[model samples]
Target: MITAEKIFKSFGTCTVLNGINLAIGAGSTIGLAGPSGSGKSTLLRCIQGLESPDSGRISREGYPGFMFQDFQLFPHMTVWDNILYAPRVRKLFPRAYLEAKADRLLRHLAIGQCKDRYPTNLSGGQKQRVALARTLILGPDILLCDEPTSGLDVAATGDVVALLKSIQNEETTIVVASHNLDFLVQISNRIILLKNGSIGADIVPQELEDPIVHLRGLCD
Candidate 1:
């Protein structure tokens, strides 16, 4: 579970997030939709603690697994190392537990064959798969994904969507901030429209004909 209230943030001359308030339940998939510069990405950074908010409190009940917009993999590190870094660094679990989890996640994500390969040796889709496996291996209570399926072919996107859904079923709450309304509509349980750095619309699955169009209206 997570709660953020009255959050305000700006970058020098421009105000990115103005009075943001949101709460996400366990296993919920909340989609953030907005125009290019509407602060969706900035809000994600704040939630992940990458960017400090000027005001408001971000209350998180447990540790989160975040997937950046770009798959930030170490080109020199082998896939296994990349997936093993989190638990190994935190010393959260036994070495055997971490290794077994990493191996299982790589296999479940269909990237086990690439375990010995360097990032440079993998394709765009393969790299993203590795990133997802790496993050999942950390066994986060929540997941923050920014434009998670922005790249890769349609088939690859589908695979990522399925994986995300499976993760959600396993009780990992997911928050995905993206400009791709169609993709968000395909995978999200709810959509929150961001306009002028504020939440303008929050629609559940049973809402109107097209949530994206309704969300776009907030930009007007």
Candidate 2:
């Protein structure tokens, strides 16, 4: 669970987030939809502590794992190494245990054969899965994904979306920021429309007869 109260963020003379308030429940999938520059990415960064809000408070019940729009994999490291790096550094578990976990995650993500390959050698979808494995390996309670399907083709997008949905359970909360309204609607129980750095509308998928029309009305 996560709660943000009166959150505000600014860059130079531009105000990106204005009194943004949010309450994300456990196991809920929240889709943040907005026009470009509406602060969806900024909000996600703030929640994950990658960026600080100028004012107000954010309280999260547990650790959050962030997946960037660009798969930030270590180009020099093999896939296996990239997945194990964080856990190895933290030393929360034994090396053997972590290695086994990495194997399981790679297999589960259907990227088992990529373990020996470098990030540069993998496809966009493969890289995305590798990034996902790295994040999920940390055992995060909240998953924060920024443009999770940003650069993929339609087929790749479908693959990533299906993988994400399959992995989500009653114990993990997932927040995805994306421009793909239909994809968001398919995966998220709640869709939040943001306009000019503020919440414009919050509605469930079934409540809208036409999501695209409603989204255009609110954002455009």
Candidate 3:
């Protein structure tokens, strides 16, 4: 499980996150919902080891992969090279063994056709998909995504969302930060609503409906 204890964060005079506590179990998806600047992305980044919080402690018992909202692909690297970077960094296995693993991951991710393409040549959805493939190549224990469907059209969002669902079905921990409440209800087994830099509501799948409306009232 991934857990956080009494988390707190501030920037100069503005307090961003205040005393958050959470436990996310394995093989489940949790949705984080809140208004702008509510610290949803920050927490995800902290979990992904992209940022250090001002104060707080977090513990992850397993490896975690993070999908960035901006599709942070290496601008100068080819798709294949991008996915191979992590394995090389950790020396996941002998070079030949890791190469075989990368080949299998590329095929599994359905990006084998794009192995030679550069990030700039792919569409937004394709770029995100490539980012997912790169992250998954590392075989993470958890997957954390930030606003992954934010700018895609409905059809594209459905495609991306379904990709996420298909990946999660294989029994990995999934956590997503999204503004789309309707979609969240369909994908997440639990929901956490953040309000005024703290947890406003946390509930299981049965209670996630109309979360945005409820959050609006609380924020007002």
Model 1: residues >4 Å from true position, as ranges? 95-97, 216-220
C-alpha RMSD values across all candidates? 2.2, 1.9, 3.0
What tens-digit string does per-residue lDDT give for candidate 3 at 27-53? 889999888898999889888878777
Q: How many pairs of residues collide in each model? A: 0, 0, 0
lDDT of 1 by residue, 1-220 (tens): 8889999999997999999999988878899888889888898888889998999999887788888878899878899998887678888899998888888777666777899999999987788888888778777888888877776678777777777777776467889987777778878889888889889788884467877677667657
**Model 1: worst 10 consecutive residues (lDDT sum):** 205-214
Model 2 deviation from native, Cα RMSD in Å: 1.9
Q: Spell out the clash pairs found in candidate 2.
A: none
Best by lDDT: 2
Best of the two (1, 2) by lDDT: 2
> What residue pairs clash in candidate 3, if any at all?
none
lDDT assessment of candidate 2: 0.88
In terms of TM-score, the best-performing candidate is: 2
Global CA lDDT computed for model 1: 0.83
lDDT tens readout by residue for model 2, 45-102: 9999999999999999887899987889999999999999898899878888888888
True-vs-predicted CA distance for residue 68, candidate 2, Å? 1.5
Q: Compared to the true structure, candidate 2 yields what TM-score?
A: 0.91
